[model samples]
Target: MKKFVLKPKIYFNEGSMEFLKEIKGSCAFIVSDSVMETLGYLQKTIDYLNETGIESAVFKEVRPDPDVKVIAEGMKKYLETQADTIVALGGGSTIDAAKGIIYSLWQFRKAAGEEFKKPLFIAIPSTSGTGSEVTNFSVITAEGEKVCIVDEWMAPDIAILDSTCIQHVPQSVVADTGIDALVHAIEAYVSTEATHCTDALAEKAVQLIFENLKALYNDASNSCARERIQNASCIAGMAFTNAGLGINHSLAHALGGTFHISHGRSNALLLSAVVEYNANLNSNDSRYASEKYARLAAVLQLPARTYREGTINFMQAVKDLLKSLGIPNRVRELGIDKSKFENKVETMVELALHDRCTPTNPRLPSREDLVGIYQKVF
Candidate 1:
């Protein structure tokens, strides 16, 4: 029988940070990046914890696309602090790093035959991307490859979405991460593992992204838009966590690992091509993905004279969105040498084919198929 699981009680809205005050803990260890510290968000979180009589410590070493070394270091800090509570405050990287640290700590204790109580894991997202707060997936770079680790224990116990913290995010980040949320929704919608539950969340998430992303991108201070997109990100995350992802993520992970492209930007760069590839009616034996794409187009209110037309319109819309956001559509446009990409193309394809996300893709991609897709986008 198929199963669906939900955890991490989510708190959102203007005063959502107050939820921290209610958490039962003596000490809290915060995992975040230097940027969050620079923005004073770290201090703001600590202040909340302090109000609750909870002592706190901060580890501000997380970076974009955090690696195993960073996780190992963070794990060390977690142990040293021995905080009863762990709060991850930042984007995907910070939340993912926090999860990795906690996971590592659990494994170490278990391996040593030592009793360990699970820390109260809380994820406070500073950006409306990745939705790592609600998901068990963590993408850590290891030896120049993005390694996806998923476990029930990795999911945060609480997810606090405070739009106040995200209001000052850069417009470029808004664009990159907004598109990433859209991709998450789309991939989940078309995943072979999708159910009515996942599809409902994915459909709403996609609609919210389409309606609010551009507005947030144009005016970062629009609280309504910001809130919508933030919720959309979490909604999409919930959808993908249950439905599973597809080749879009697999391809993005491989490309990001090899070229050091930012995760959201990498996903945005590959979106149109991946959609077109997935929507191919002639080669794909199954009509399920194509129908799902058509449904998504319908949700966006794009004209759908036929399934193919709807699918094409969806692809064009993605392309248009990328252009408007100043995102490069081709990998070469991002300054990678064409010859070098070609040389690494085979290796990337192999990595993607073996990615955990690939198995759930509606259409099974062949080696040649993946190569062609990469070449076209390159």
Candidate 2:
């Protein structure tokens, strides 16, 4: 059996903020980060929610890679306020923090023999990556490793994508997050677990991103680019959240938790190499893998005459995109010594093999294969 999970209420277009008035609650618990608050986004969301006559309070404790301790602290605040609803206002990390808070709350209540009540939740994305607003997956770091919490019931009731919120995102963030969306689409489409619905979402997302990411990177004022990227991010999120991701994400997760590298940036740096390595795993499967890569190359208008040419073009395009975006191209460029990476490759392999995202990878990498991919990227 196949199941597709998405937000119950999705509002898009000009002045979607009007949906705020329809919120059915007395108090709202907002989860956000300092960046969004500093950009005045959190305030804007609070003001709008307040206009709906709902008293609102914010838990601005969400960090880049939401840690278990941070979530626990937020849950403490949530329980204290007795808020009936959660309004997550920011990127994936902030929305994910809200997920952790709600789940922990239910678990805590259940432990005390109290019935679990679902919170009326709304997610408003400030950035175009992460699609956390629409997905049921929540990622949190525990014991210096990133862990994914999956449950269909955790899907938000509503997802609000406002292009205006993306204006404040920095250029580097745009590049990293945009690449994150691209990686999500490609990985999902190529995933062994992919379904028809996810494939459609992923393909459209890939097309949208290849067309608009550069424009958004070059000019934030371009609303057309902003809207496309935002829409693509959500579509990619929906795809990967259902079909799951692959080695690129698994490796990125390890790097994020271990070294504090930004999740999207880590993914951006590693995606091309992982894709190439996976495609090279078997000659018979080569054409199948190369076809999607060739399509990617064509979408970006790179040079590609054959499957081999397509693979090379796709790799080059990804590397060029990362360089143009001012992101470091390799783990070594991020200041980690190459030797450290070589020594840690085994551990990374073990962790990645067990990652929830790994089973769906087009290439089911063995420990040695993971090491080889890491070494090449390193």
Candidate 3:
């Protein structure tokens, strides 16, 4: 049986952060990062929960790429506070760290055969990317490798998309995270496991990204653009969580983890090459991916009279979008020395080949295929 999980009760629109006032729990454990603390987002969340008379214990230890140690540390604090709820209030990393802590707690209690009441999990994203708030996937680093953990119960019970939380975000962050959402939509649309249901969500997400990402990047204060991009991110997350992702994500996880690159920027750099690789236009074969990509191009109302033209148009549109956003089009732009990147090639390739996202790739890539793409990006 194939099951599509759309579990989160998402709250969006103006003043949606007040949903926290409806939170029911003795104490809400908030998982966030230093950035959120500095921006007073952490305080904003606490205040909302406080309105309901719920206590708060803040764990502001999450980092860019949440590692296993920090999750353990957060769990220790979670247990100490005896929090009945968990409010993940930040970007993807903070949300993933919160999910990890909750997952660990579940496993520990199950192993110990102790009765445990599952905490109510709520996610408040401070950025419009990753869709960690709605998806059952979480990435945590262990031993310097990015590991994606997928579980039905790992999805947040509630997702709040409050514009208040995302106001005046930096342009660089807007570009990076917005592009990640675009990648999510594109990858899911062409994933081998994609169903009609997922296609609908992914298509709408693609349209939204194309329409609003540039506007948001140019003017972070554009409330309409901001809300739409956030919606697009969540929609794309819903799409991929149900449809599964592909080699782009696999390669990105490996590349980012291996080099300490920002996840969104890493995905951004690899996107064009991945599209070309998957489309395989040079092979002159009418591939499934080409058709899927063509469908998206058609949705964007690009001049795609045929699948081939559609594929080419799609690739070019993506490149143009990246250029418009000021995202680096080549891996070399990140300043990693050529020799060092080449040296790590084998390690990255192996990790990518074995990544959870690879198997669902429309075209199963071999070592040579992966190597060529990596070198092309360089």
Q: Write the per-residue lDDT of candidate 1 for residues 88-143, one digit (tens) a residue.
A: 99999999989888888788889999888889999999889798989999999999
Per-model TM-score versus the true fold:
0.98, 0.93, 0.98
Q: Between candidates 1 and 3, name the one with more favorable lDDT.
A: 3
RMSD of each: 1.2, 2.1, 1.1
- Give the residue spans of candidate 2 off by over 4 A: 111-113, 285-288, 295-309
Error of 3 at 203 (Å): 0.6
- Tens-place lDDT per residue, model 3, 187-295, is 9989888989899999999999999999989887899999999999999999999989998999999999988998999999999999999999778665899989999
TM-score for candidate 2, please give it.
Answer: 0.93
Clashes of 3: 0
Any residue pairs clashing in model 2, and if so which?
none
lDDT of 1: 0.90
Score residue 61 of candidate 2 by CA lDDT.
80
